[model samples]
Target: MLFLRSRVEYTKEQLFKIEQLRQLVQKSSELDVGTDDTFLTKFLHYTHWDSVKAYQAIHAYYDFKHKHPTWMAQHPIEYYRKLFYATHCRFVMPRTDKNGRVLVIFKTVDAFQQFPDYLQGLIEMDDLIFESLLMLPRVQQNGITVICDLQGTTRNFLRQFSPQFMKVVNDKNGVLPFTQRIVHIIQRGFLMHVTSSLFLPFMNKEFKERIFTHDGKHLSKLREMVGYESLPAEYGGPADNVLDTNLIFNHLSQSADYLEKLQHYKKRIV
Candidate 1:
């Protein structure tokens, strides 16, 4: 955190680059995102505090979004609301991780539900979840730790994985702020086995490295890592304050009415 604070202090050349990048983005896209200090700060952080690299990253992100317009396009908050309650619910806990990072729970049972396009729902959820995390100041700083509960991943879901989806996962992961702290894979089922044996090679190296596995008996380890008070009751922890994906969905869209405006691009998706 200290390093980030110190590195963000700009020299004259960096200021010039930031301005250049700002204009470049303004000219290139419909979003007034370049002018946003928060937007550029992500690029700056992702590029290891190099303003030039940050600008390049912004350009790449712009190009990527343009090339994949469908992926970047916004949807109704109601769509997200429904997807939240779908087979896969990625809800944030009412608590933080041991390192003061946000803890996001990815619990799934029947993941291949047909209500919404599975792949697209995953992407949209990623954006909404990150937006929700940013609402908490500590997450905006310390990032998030994911609890990927794979207790009931089906064989059918494993067969649905594609190179395109994996690529999107890696690409989008690079752009997001405070993205990965740790990804705890609880209950090593067949899906986890497939992911490690086949799909792991395709994912980002850092993402692969941070994943830790545990079975049902050791669920308390997560409570120890974060806190018993922070975890949800279903996870065998003591957090009595209830939380659900729908509540999390509401938290992200609460500040704005983009659905009424029919806006095509959500601010957070950028």
Candidate 2:
């Protein structure tokens, strides 16, 4: 068995395999993945520092990205904001979970008015999130907390889970940076249909355990896991909720200037 080299013990063969796997990826469509030191290190940790598993994980990641390029493409700022203001999705400010892992929140409502064709947009945003998530500093070794809020939503989110997409989700999800520490699902009683239809088949035993279902009355627990103030008003948190689309759009436009400078700096270190 292979182990993450520096943290644990590893064989020479494992070391060779790491390089071999790196070469394999360099030749693949996702030429940049599985080759960077950060990714190599992160994948190792994800697999208990096992080199072979790390190699396989890296390959799966690149393969998934190539196979489903649209799965996680970054869209324009206005496009993303529309999805957020439409009441279908939102990515609150990044923070850490109880375990210090990066916490990512995704809030969705019943039907997205005007933009009824939410599958493509929601799916795009989901992919964009995971991609952007990789750039986080805490993302390398620290894990992730994916919160799915379906308190007031319909099961429409599951409409995209065809056999093809299911395979894509399952294959790539396993190798994503850090283990999925917990997938906190709010309003499980009313939304189990959504979870069962879309998520259950993609989950393994370990993944299923990481997923915790909560009733509507469990905001305290939600708050405890992910601090209440960080959540938006819709989630019963103190943060500013997008009250109007025009204002939200203006906010995004303003944000682009700041983000350009911020992302420029972010590139050097993260």
Candidate 3:
């Protein structure tokens, strides 16, 4: 499935262009309203795409303030009126087959939407998805697998495989603070998965502070499941540092395996 997350300022023409591109490459497609099982469930409790306008207003105010600090200081409401003009755009496109199994395609990583509400919602949704996908079991009987199609050159591959990835890279080297936050969420998810076998009390505490801090109530349940009190402070034994990287690589490997299995399953069914 082409799991997508973006700002919500896309014009009808731009949206159509993206849709046409998907149709050319993918056999089937669907839009994820941040409700897909892949990555959005964990983060966004509620979302309203219509709020894009409010976000644009807020951004415009900030832009005006940045450009004319003295004027903004004197006319705050006027500055806010200018901020309202800033629009943030985002959208999603997913592809699936007759059997209802998702076929991975492409995703756009651009913050095309200039509105804050829309951007915030997307951020929350992406983080949740990234975290949940990272934490899923390495292999599952009924789960979307993760994979890294690195066979093609970065440019051509991103264009054909996942244009969104390229947009992010070209826009800012994909190193913006927001991007880093998303990556960190993914990394934490990876560490959680690989180190599920390891048990320690302090480890849970650290997770609560670092990863689960955003959602305290949820972390409380996890802490209970692991029986926090029983874990020793130094229990992870020394392998915790590289846990995130290992998990990411493992997720990619498992995704590749899933693709192979999907092909085989399709053949058998046919």
Candidate 4:
């Protein structure tokens, strides 16, 4: 099993790979650009929206910029500016451990919110509105692990950052509205686990442990204070209804899968 520490390290390696790929993509001809799409398509076969592909895509674009500094300088200000905005848009952090593995961390809806005000002010001073918008705040896990947060509208943001990886469940084909609701419910369940189990635990351990270790008397008392008869299903508490049970199970399964994959990735890096 891989420790949380090593996972962070692996993420750095992945980031490096992404940067290299981006450079290669940038220099290649327009026809060659499709290669990245092909690569992404292959990557998408297994992964979902929050997969490695998104990380790789953003890095690839960064590499392109590095190789085409002069092109950016020569193009019309407005044209180049828009291109720059489109390509250099997402924010990603490199979370790594001693042995260099990626750590699982929060996926901020808007990474720019994580940036320091000073840095943001500098970007604004340069009149780099586009770049400024891309700045994101990130917290390193254990003060070493890197975390990535993407900015912009969620759909457009994901498309730019990880085009192939983000799942497109709803296309032109109309599905029942309830299906969308179900999907959201499932996604929410997974998010709750990430927030409560992964992020919240790091924030406060004693408080969390207290909830878990409490006897029925304390648990009941706490529940009353919180206004719930029992713990929510995402936290592994008993379900009050069939829908709750299904949602809880779905969340538990997703969390288990995510943790397992993270462990697997960490082992490879270690």
Candidate 5:
């Protein structure tokens, strides 16, 4: 319901603050990280342009990568190719909202059941998508909105959104350098309520307030929240803008140089 905020404004003062944050990052031996304008600007934006807090955010970001080394490991491209073709589980909407915030949706079905190993692949895939979005100036400036579409998943499958698992997710999300403006859960029936209950206890107050839920049958509430024009066709939008996993996969495939650079950066993390 809170998707009406404006995109980040880059005033002259803000630009100066970004430069200060860049110098702080470059000078620190502990934080050997990217000092690109977009990277530093987003960190400053996330911390309200406070250089000290933004520096701490940079440390938190790398600290996460150091703790989860496997998530940052460079696997063969074929692994991702197979994962994409085998299970088209996640897709980032090609369009952004009125505020320039991109919408990332993860549909839940029996796709994972077919490939038991995809669970890990799914996590890695999400990391790739998240990192890819971070590279975009529009995404970095405005932030992102996520929709977990659970329409086709069984109640048994929904059981995985447990308190412990979501707590870990919450902890990890705390360190991300970008803003997550809103999170929408699309589902219906008793399991929807149960899943919501499971996730609420673990979320911090800010994130908890940013969440909104919608039943798959209704389009008006969702449309009012994020606008019908911003959503995919499956969610009662235009037929031409259908959700396509191949588009996202193709973008990542073509970004070999950038992905390689990201791998190189991850390797430098200690």
Candidate 6:
């Protein structure tokens, strides 16, 4: 239950912990981690300022990157340009919530079903979006909430995400530098319920608890949680406030240089 507090400034104790985490990073020859205050502080906050946990999380992060290089690859601007125009796959909301947490919406119905062959590509797209978001200090501190609209998608959509793959994705997400404050799955149908049940075992306890499901009939809870103003029109917000895929593409295009630098952080296999 280590919820992030609204401490814009680090406390004396946290400053000490940051240095401790820095020492841990410095001592480890295997961990190619950034020791800068901004970078290291992200891990400390993710683990509630526990230096040891932050160090371990950093290790896990780099290890996972080494294993899945495709997820870290920077795509050309044209690649994202085509992807954005072609599909309504994923988009981060244009605004942050009252808590300063960003909202990232995933259109499962459009994405999973439409592009079965591009599952890994979908994952790479997610990484790019998250990396872009995590670049913001406010987003890194407050974290983000995810609203996965699964209303139109069926059990078949779950087929592409097998137990093994679910486990890998879940594990990778757990050690991510950015924290996921909440995840609201809005859907209906007994099959969808069953599909959700199948993936629960792979989740860690903390993440499992953050999940909230809705039947799509009642979005009052969703509206209240993420704020009605923050949601797009598709999710019961103002019509004109719909997700701007073009804006996302533009942001990614601008972040091309920074994303390119991230590619060098992966462990080099001998």
Tens-digit per-residue lDDT, 64-153, candidate 2: 555565655345665677566656355534335556665566666655456776666777656555544443335555667777776545
Residue pairs with backbone atoms closer than 3 Å in model 6 (clashes):
none
Q: Candidate 1 residues 1-270, lDDT tens each?
A: 311222345568757766766776666544435365455555555565566677666656655666665555276566666666755467777667667767788765565657536756776666656644544435545677888776666775666667876676677666555634687777665666665455556667777787777775668677777677777787777647465765566565663353223234323334
Assess each prediction's global lDDT (C-alpha) against the native: 0.62, 0.57, 0.26, 0.27, 0.73, 0.75
> Candidate 2: misplaced stretches above 4 Å?
1-34, 74-79, 110-113, 155-168, 188-198, 224-270
TM match of model 4 to true structure? 0.18
lDDT of 5 by residue, 62-138 (tens): 77777675555366444688777766778877778656788888876566567775556777787787777776666
Candidate 4 lDDT by residue in tens digits, 1-270:
222212222356445554555555455343133323223222222123233554454344434434432211222223223222323332211222232322221123333434333223222222222121111111111111212221112432333333221111111111111111100011233333333233222323332332222222233433332223223332223464111222212322333433222221110111
Best by TM-score: 5
For candidate 5, report its TM-score: 0.85
TM-score of 3: 0.19
- Candidate 3: regions farther than 4 A off: 1-36, 39-246, 257-270
lDDT of 2: 0.57
lDDT of 4 at 72: 19
Q: What is the lDDT of residue 65 in candidate 4?
A: 39
Model 5 misplacement above 4 A: 1-15, 71-73, 76-78, 155-163, 266-270
What residue pairs clash in candidate 2, if any at all? Answer: 4-49, 110-153, 110-154
Q: Give me the runs in candidate 6 sitting further than 4 Å from their true place.
A: 1-27, 33-37, 71-78, 110-116, 154-156, 268-270
Q: On a 0 to 100 scale, what is the lDDT of residue 110 in model 2? A: 56
Native-referenced Cα lDDT, model 4: 0.27
Candidate 1 residues lying further than 4 Å off, grouped into runs, are: 1-24, 27-34, 86-88, 111-116, 132-137, 239-241, 256-270
Q: Any runs in candidate 4 off by more than 4 Å, and if so which? A: 1-214, 217-220, 229-245, 252-260, 267-270
What lDDT score is found at residue 167 in candidate 4?
18
Better candidate number, 3 or 4, judged by lDDT: 4
TM-score of every prediction relative to native: 0.76, 0.66, 0.19, 0.18, 0.85, 0.83
- The alpha-carbon root-mean-square deviation between model 1 and the true structure, to one decimal in Å, is 5.5
Q: What is the lDDT for 219 in model 3?
A: 35
